[model samples]
Target chain A: MSTEVAIVGIGMHEFGRTDGVSGMDQGVVAVRRACADAGVNWEDIQFAFGGSMAAGAADTMVSLLGLTGLQFINVANGCATGGSALFSAYNTIRSGVFDLGIAIGFDKHERGAFRVNTKGGGLGDWYGASGLALTTQFFGMKINRYMHEYGITQSTLAKVSEKAFRNGSMNPMAWRRKPISEEEVINSPMLSYPLTQYMFCSPGEGGVALILARADKAHLYTDKPIYLRAAVVRSRRFGSFEVLAPSIALEHNAGPTVDASKAAFEMAGMGPKDMDLAQLQDTESGAEVMHMAENGFCEHGEQEFMIQAGDTEIGGKFPVNTDGGCLANGEPVGASGLRQVYENVLQLRGQAGARQVPNDPKTAYTHVYGAPGISGVTILSR
Target chain B: MSQVPVTEGVFTWPSDSPQLIGSRCVACGNHMFPVQQGCPKCTAAETEEVLLGRRGTLWTWTVQGFPPKAPPYAGNVDPKTFEAFGVGYVELPGQLKVESRLTEADPEKLRIGMEMELVIVPLSKDSDGNEIVTFAFAPVA
Candidate 1:
C-alpha cells in the first residue's frame, strides 16, 4: 500500500531537566524549531496531535502560538503517546482531510522514583502498601524470570546500559551523557534486584515536535523528507504481562509490542530484515532486550549472545537505539516516543552526528511499549 | 484490637488457609482475581465466585528498597522508616499466576520455582486501631 504522509521537519528540546521551564514552553521551543526547520509558518498547520503526560492539554500551545483555531487533540497512551500522535496525524493526512499538521510531545515530572496513582489506575491500597505498584518491580521480575529461563546474565543487562550511555554521550539531546563502564552500571544502587539506578530511566523534562505534510506537498517544506511507511498502535487484551497489573489468569495471547510490530510490518510490506536500524523502547535495560525480540529483530534466546558479542552497537548487524534510547536519554513520558522518531529521521537524513550509522540507512524502525502493555511501532524511509 | 482486611472482597478473613477471592467463568472456566463480573477471556457473562489456590510455586520476584510513591498506598507510615519488601508473581496450580508480596526480602532466601503458600500478614494499621491485613506468600517446607 502507498503511505503518503511525510515528515518534513523534526525538532527536539534536549531531553533533560530545565528548572522553571514549563512543559508548554518546552513544547513551544520544539514546535517553533520544527516549523523553522520545515520552512513553514505555524499558521500553516491545519491540524495537530499532541502527547503530554503530566503536562496540560494540547490546547495549551494555543496561548503561545496564538489561537489558530486548529484541531488539536491531546494523547495520553502511556509511552506510546507521541507515537500515537504521529500516527493520528499520518492517518488524518492520508485521508486527504488535512494537508499539513504537527505532532508534539512533552512532559515534566519530579525527580526520583516516578509515583503512579493507583486509585483509578486499576491498582489499589494492597498494591501500593506492598510496594507492588512500582514499575521497577515489574521490570525486575520480568528480567529475573527471563534470565532464569534463558542463560542471560547480569553482564548482558549491564552491557545494554553501557551501549546506551556510550551512544548518549554522542547525542547532545540525550539526558545522561557521561559514558560509564559496565561495572558502574552493575554496582549502582539497586532499585529492584537486578535493575540498578543506571538500568532505569529517571523521569525528567523534555519535548519533541515533528512537522508532517502530504507526500506531494512535502517537498514544499524540505527536500530531505522522511516518509511514514507504517504506523501502528496496539493495546493489551488478555494474557499480556506488563507493569501495573495485579494478576494474570493465563498468557493465552501475544503482548502489545508483538501485536503492534506485526501489524506495522504487515502494513509496510517490510519485515525487520529490511530496516537498517531501530530505536526499541528501553524504559529499562530489560525492556530493550525484550522489545528487540518482540519487534522481530531477534529471537528470545539470542539477545544475550548479540549483546555480549558487541552486535548491538552503531556498527553492528542491526545498530539498534542509535540515539541512546530511553535508558540513556531518560524517559520524559510524552516526549520519548517522538524522540525515537526524531532520531530515526536524523539517521535516515544523514543528520545524526557522531552516533550516525555508517552507509546512509534507507529505512528505519522505532517501537515503544509502556505500562499496562500498550505499544506503538512506526516505519520510516527516505 | 481486631484484624481486618486492607481491602474487602479479596480474601477470606479469620481463616487457617485462605484463598484469594476470585471469579471463574461458568462457561469457559477462566478465572480472575478480586472478582470481575464479566469474563475477559471469552467475554462470557455467566461467572461464579471462586477461591484461588493457596499453594503455588514462585515464578519471579524482586526486592523494592525505597518507599512506594504515595496516594493509594494510603498507609500512614513515615517514608524514612519504610522497610524493604519482596514482590513476586506466584504460579498457582490450575489457576493464574498472581502477584504477591513475599514473606522474605533477602535474595539468598528466595529462589525461582520454590514452593510457596498463601499467608495473611499485617500491612498497616488503620486510624481505628485495626491492623490492616493483606495477602503474602511464604516458602513452604
Candidate 2:
C-alpha cells in the first residue's frame, strides 16, 4: 500500500568542474532554487534526504540553510546515491509521517578514473592492485565479453557515444556538447581494449534537488507535478556479475537492472510500451548497450542494430538519454541519479528546448546501477 | 630467491602449482573466493577453508591502458615504468569466477574460453625490499 507523492519542484547546478567549491554550497544552491520553484520556504521542509559519495552528511543544512529542527538523513548507494535518497524520501512521505520532503544529491569528486579502496570488507591487496578495481576495466571486459558472445563489432559500439554526443550538443547544462563522429569515438585513444576514453564519463561535480509533496496537497505547491509512480532500489543476486563483486557465482541469476526494472514497471502499473522516454545509466557506451536490453527496452543482441538504425534518437521509436546522459554531463555520483530525473521532468514539462522528445512524453523512466551490485529506478507519469 | 604475496592467506605459493584460497559452505556446497564469514547464498555458518584449483577458463578480459588511481594500488611502479596490462575474470571449473591480472597484455591474443593457468607474479617491494607478489592467469603453456 503505497501512498501518492508528487514532485512539485526540481533544480540542478551546472554539471562541470566546481573547483574550490564545496558540495554543501552546491546543494544549498539547488535547494534554494527548488524551494523558490515550489513557492515554498526552506523552513517549510519537514524532512530532507540526501545522497553523496564524497560529501559529508546533508543534515548539516541546519547550520547552512538555517532550517533547523527537522529529520535529515544521508544515503549512499554507490552510483545510485541520488535515486536511493529520492526513493527513501518518497516512501517516508507516503508513510504519512511527513507531508513535504526534500531529496538532495551532491558531489565534488576528484578528476580522472574511479578507484576502489582494497582494504577490509573481505577484499585484500591483490584485489586492488589487480587493476580490475578500476571501473573502466569492468566496462571494457563486459563489452568485450558481449562482443565475443554476440558478434557485435567495434563500429556498433561507437554508435552509442556518437548519439550521446549529438544529443548532448543540444543540452546547455551538459559537460561535453560537441557532436562527435563515429570515427572520433572509435579512435579516441582506447582506455580499455574495447572502450575508448570518450566512451566513459569522467567523475565530476554537481548537485540536484527535488521537492516532493503528498498527492492531495501537491496542487498547493505547483500545478504541474510529476507523479512518482514507482521508486525501487535493488541489489544484484547470485551470478549477477556486477562491478565490485570480486567473484562471480558459477550459476546464473538475474542482474540488478533486470530485477529492478521489472519491479518498477509492476509497481507503476506500466510496461515498457508506456514509457515515452528513458534515462538509463551509461557509465560507458557498453553499459548503455547492455542496459537497454537488460531493462527490457530491447532484446539482447538487438541493441547493436538499434544503435545502427538510429531508433534511439529523440524522435525515434525509443528515445533515451535525451539530455546527453552521463557521457555528456559526466558523473557526479550522488547527483547523477537526480540529474536524470531532472531531465525527465523538463521533458515532461515541455521545458527542454532543443532536446525535447517528440509527440510530448506522458511517462518517463530513469535508472542507475554501479559498484556493489545496486540498481535504482524511478518512473514518472503526468 | 624469496617471494611474498601481496596479501597473506589468499593463495598458496612456493609450490609446483599455486591455488587460490576460498571458502566452501558446508550446508549448501557453494564456493566463494577470498573467503567469507558465512555463505551468503545459504546463510550457513559452518564453512571450511579450501584451496581452489589453479586451472580455469578465461571468461573475459580487458586492457588497462591507463593507470588506476593509487592508495590500495600502492604506486610501487614509477610513472615512466607504467605498462598496460590485461585484467579479467577467470571461471574456475564448476566453482566460481575470480578476477585477476592477466600475464598477456595484447588484446588480440586474448580470447574468451581460452584455457588459463594461475601463476604468482611480483607486484612491488615493501620497505625492506621483500618482493610482493600477486596472482594472475595466463594462457597455458
Candidate 3:
C-alpha cells in the first residue's frame, strides 16, 4: 500500500515587490516559520526542494535555510516550479524514503527576468528571436482571438479586472490593495491588443514554504493537517497544437490545464462540483475565466455569464482566488504554486479570515501552469 | 544589392523557386513545418523530408505594434516601428497552418483564406556582413 502525504504546516512571507532583501533571505524566513509551525526542527527535514525561476543560485537558497544536511534539488519550471517542488516533496514522503520534507519557493523582484531559459527555445523563438518576456503578449493573442470569435468587448475584460481588484482589496497581502475602477482598467495603457496594463499580473517578491510528512507524523505536527489527496504534473506533447483544426486549437498547450484538472479529479474521486473552492493561476483576468471554463467549473463560453451573475464572488456559487490570485496578489514566479497551496490549506483549515468560504470547505483544488507547457494540479482535503 | 547565400551552399532546393522545407511522418502521416526532430504523433524519429507547397491561404494575422522586450530580436526600432507589422497563420494545400509575418503592412489588404506565397527576407546582417534571412508570407499573384 502506498503511504499518504499531508501538509502539516505552511508559512508565507508578505507578497509584494521587494528590493530590500534577497530571495534567499525571503526563503529562509518562510522555511524557519514552517519548521516552527510544524514543531519539527530544521535538521529533521530529510529532503529540500527549492523552486525559483530567476534566482540563478538555487543551492545557496537551500543552504541559507540551514538545511545543509538534507538532500536538495532545485527546480525552475517557468512559473510552475513551486508546485513541481511540492510534488517532489509529496512523492518523497509517499515513497517512504523520507518521513518529512520541505519545499521552499521564493523570488525577488530585482532578480526577475522576462525570458526563462533560452536552452530549448520557446514561442518567441519561432517569431525570429523575439525576446518578449511579458507573457501578457501571448495572453493578448488569446484575448484577441476570444474577442474576434465571441465578440467579447474590452468592457467585459475590464469588468474581470475590476472584480479581481475589488477582491484584492480584502487581501492585505495583495500588491495593489487599492480597488480599481472599470474606467481605470479600460483606459489603462494597452500592452497588447485586447489586453491592457491592468489586465496583466504584477511582478512581486515573496516566498511560500510547505512541510509535507507521512500521514502518521502529520498528527504530531498540526491538528489542521490537509491531506494531499492528489498531485499530478503533465507537459504538452510537442506539436499537439498543430494537429488540431485551426478553429479549435486556439493556442498551443492550452489543453493541459483541463487535462491536468480532470486527472486530479479522477485521482481524488471527485469532480468540479465537489470542490468547495478553487484557486487558479490567474496570471491575467481573462485567464481566470478561461481556465475556469477549461477546468470544467463552467461550460465553455459560459464563463462571461457566470462572472456577470456574480457566481465567482465571495458569497457566490463558487469562490475563486479568494485570497486574490497572481493578478492581484502578484506573480512571484517560483512562489506562485505554493501560494495557491497556501490559500487552499488556509481555506481547508478554516483559517482564511475575511475571504473565508462560508460552508467550511472540506475539499479544494489548485491549478498552476508554467511557460512552455508545464502544468501542475493538486487537491487538498481536511 | 549585396551577395546573399541561398540553399545552394547547404542542401539542394527541390525547385528553382523558394519553397519551405518540412517533414512528413510515415506512422501517422502528420505534416510538420520547419521539420521536427521527431514525429509528434507516434514519436517515430524516422521521417522523410518533403518540400512544402509554395502557395498557401492566410488563416489569421496580427501586426506587432511594439518591439519585443527580450533578446535575439534584432529590430532595434522603437515600439512605434511595429505599429504596422503583421503576423498571422497561413493554411497550406495540405491543411497545414503555419505562422509567419506578413510582407504587407496594411491590415485591410490582408484577408483570411487569401492565397499567399512564402518569401525569405533578410532579417539583419552580422558584424561580418553575413545576411541572416528568415521566412515571411506575402499575397500570391
Cα lDDT over the full model 2: 0.86
User: Any runs in candidate 2 off by more than 4 Å, and if so which?
Assistant: A120-122, B75-77
Which tens-of-lDDT digit does each residue in A300-368 have in candidate 3? Answer: 677767777878887889988888788788888889889899888988988888878898889988998
Fnat for every candidate? 0.73, 0.78, 0.13
Q: Which stretches of candidate 1 lie over 4 Å from their true place?
A: A1-3, B74-80
- Supply candidate 1's per-residue lDDT for A16: 83
Instruction: Please rank every candidate by DockQ, starting with the best.
Output: 2, 1, 3
Find the candidate with the highest lDDT and give its number.
1
| TM-score of chain A for the candidates in order shown | 0.98, 0.97, 0.91
lDDT (Cα, tens digit) per residue for candidate 2, span A1-382: 6579999999888887877778878888889889998999998999999978877677786698885688888887778889889999999988999999999998888778876765633466667765557778888888898888777788877888888999999998888989999999988998898999888888888899999999889999998898999999998887778776678888877798999999999999999888998999999888888888889898889987887888888988998899989999989899999999999989998889988998988999999988778899999998
Model 3 lDDT, full chain set? 0.72
Enumerate the candidates' DockQ scores in order.
0.70, 0.73, 0.26
User: Which runs of model 3 end up more than 4 angstroms from their true locations?
Assistant: A109-113, A122-134, A147-152, A242-254, B3-17, B55-63, B77-84, B103-117, B120-133, B138-141
Please give the C-alpha DockQ score of model 2. Answer: 0.73
At residue B94, give the lDDT of candidate 2.
78
lDDT on C-alpha atoms for all candidate structures: 0.88, 0.86, 0.72
